[model samples]
Target: MIPVVPLDRSREAALRALVDGKAKPLGALGRIEDLAVRLALISGREDPSFDKALLLVFAGDHGLNQAGVSAYPSAVTTAMVATLLAGRASANAFARVVGAEVRVVDAGVAADLAPHPALVDAKVRRGTRNAASQPALTPDEVQSALARGAAVARRAVEAEGFDILAVGEMGIGNSASAALILHRLAPAPLADCIGLGAGHDAEGLARKHAVLAQAAARSDASDPPGVLAEFGGLEIIAMAGAILGAAAARTPVLVDGFIASTAALAAIRLEPAAADYCIFAHRSAEKGHALVLEAAGAEPLVDLSMRLGEGTGALLALPMVRAAAALLSEVASLDDVLAGRL
Candidate 1:
């Protein structure tokens, strides 16, 4: 069965009526009003809760990182995952601010991460091979990564009962991979998909563009899996699977920045119905992210010039998701308003 069920539009009127009947005037809750209706429709429950949310950071290295496209070294991917595990990373700080537990998955980091409570050791391989010169992974390897990602989402929802999810990626050159995916899936121009990731210089940006164009020209993804295996990092693949898994369980998801949005695109490509389960958290300062967000049919909650991954963007938006639910359940109805029960 497809993971995401088609949203039941039959109930739209009743749901919106409920939102409109809230104590405040119509649209007073603004986007949260829309958020409330959408969540109710997606979950098939008028009074759903955003009480629990899970954050997944899928970390990996990219062969394309060796091509000098990113300003950060590939080693930063593994190092940052270490910081995530230590709970001292920026993601953790925001996670605390937003109320969530963090889980780091070693999707395919080049370095070996020691066992940690917060880490899911689901490494597909050391890292992806250089896509500029070769295929990123075997088709079989791609499926493995996808399954690992889906399994994590399942555990979060089924075992832990998380009602919402956020998927993020950590990979140095994955931005190039994301661009390639958006170029293929979004079918945007190579230039439109290209961006100055991690602040590349003029020469670096030019070289980055040249390499991504070459990679795009050389590779073609025939299907969702093909698109992912051809250009996506392990972390990206896992994130896509997590999205699909969450959608399958009727759990809402907050998509993070460029790479995470690309993963969400892949998930939707695999199953278009998954889009109903996603909420874009924020726009990234990184280039090409807007195009990807457009392709995903998402309007982010904020634009804070945030480009850091590790699920921070979505975590920052967690309150909005929760607030929508809170308002829906806590506020008095218009009937109560008319009855002078406020």
Candidate 2:
């Protein structure tokens, strides 16, 4: 097990000095400056750089889709996973543009995909059981999913030597599951966070809300592990573990869309220090996402009205992170300026 690192005062002081030296008035960059400082602290480097980036897309299926929560069929999860591995998914295109390696992990898709060289067969199960009808996953399944996610993070950090990790998910009806988890974990109402997931109409949205409400009522928020066991999808639980593992490894984690944010929330609850390593990649257009971000006090890097959950938003924001790092590492300091340095 990778040990978690607590944020140290020395690291914080170095971050402050670096940010204050940026080519702007102190604190003028606002949250962007804060973001750079946070990245520095998490990586334990006075100057942080995401020269090598890895985006892990964990695919699964939510049994809750049987309740009409999503317009797309559950098979779409497997299909998208295949598409991603084929380098044809939107996430692949975005990652290509940003020069980041994308890896697709089969967390728990319902479909039986034959051995494909492109796919990382980290299957925890065929898929989660219906949460609206029963528990989404068994305790063993949840534990296995988390362990798989952590293993993936370990490989990314130890083998690939990635400086930044982005989290993404593909699961039908997962938005509903995330909403339920958010409702239970956050001090927010279910209705406020529920949204028209995957282009659901009024009736579909109504049904999604109802299913989440039922799951929320039955959940025991006091026991987060139990809540996750009872209502969380494999992808969400896996993501929670990834966040914790990434933090333990002291790598900067870029949280993707709504589902990814909810997973981060779960990991944050488990270890509050984990938040120090997380970067809210974007403010998802999903109705519940904004509330989740607010509840966690996360200021996202982008607000392009993105609803995509395949780490596309996180990839889009990577350039900004790279730029921040470059400024810190390459830009001249105030001492250089005062000494008439060229």
Q: For every model shown, what is its TM-score relative to the native structure?
A: 0.97, 0.95
**Deviating ranges (above 4 Å) for candidate 2:** 1-3
For candidate 1, write residues 1-342 as lDDT tens digits: 236786878999988988998888789778889898888887787777887878999999999988987888999988888888899998899888888989998999999889999999899999998888888989899888888898899889999988899888788888888888888888788899888777788999999998888787787665777777788689998899899888888889999999899999888888899999889999999889999888888899899999988788999999988888877778889899899997
Per-candidate total of colliding backbone pairs: 1, 0
Model 2 agreement with the true structure over 153-218: per-residue lDDT tens digits: 877898879988998988888888888888878857889878877788888777777877777776
Model 2 collision count = 0
The C-alpha RMSD in Å for every predicted model, in order, reads 1.3, 1.8
Candidate 1 global TM-score: 0.97
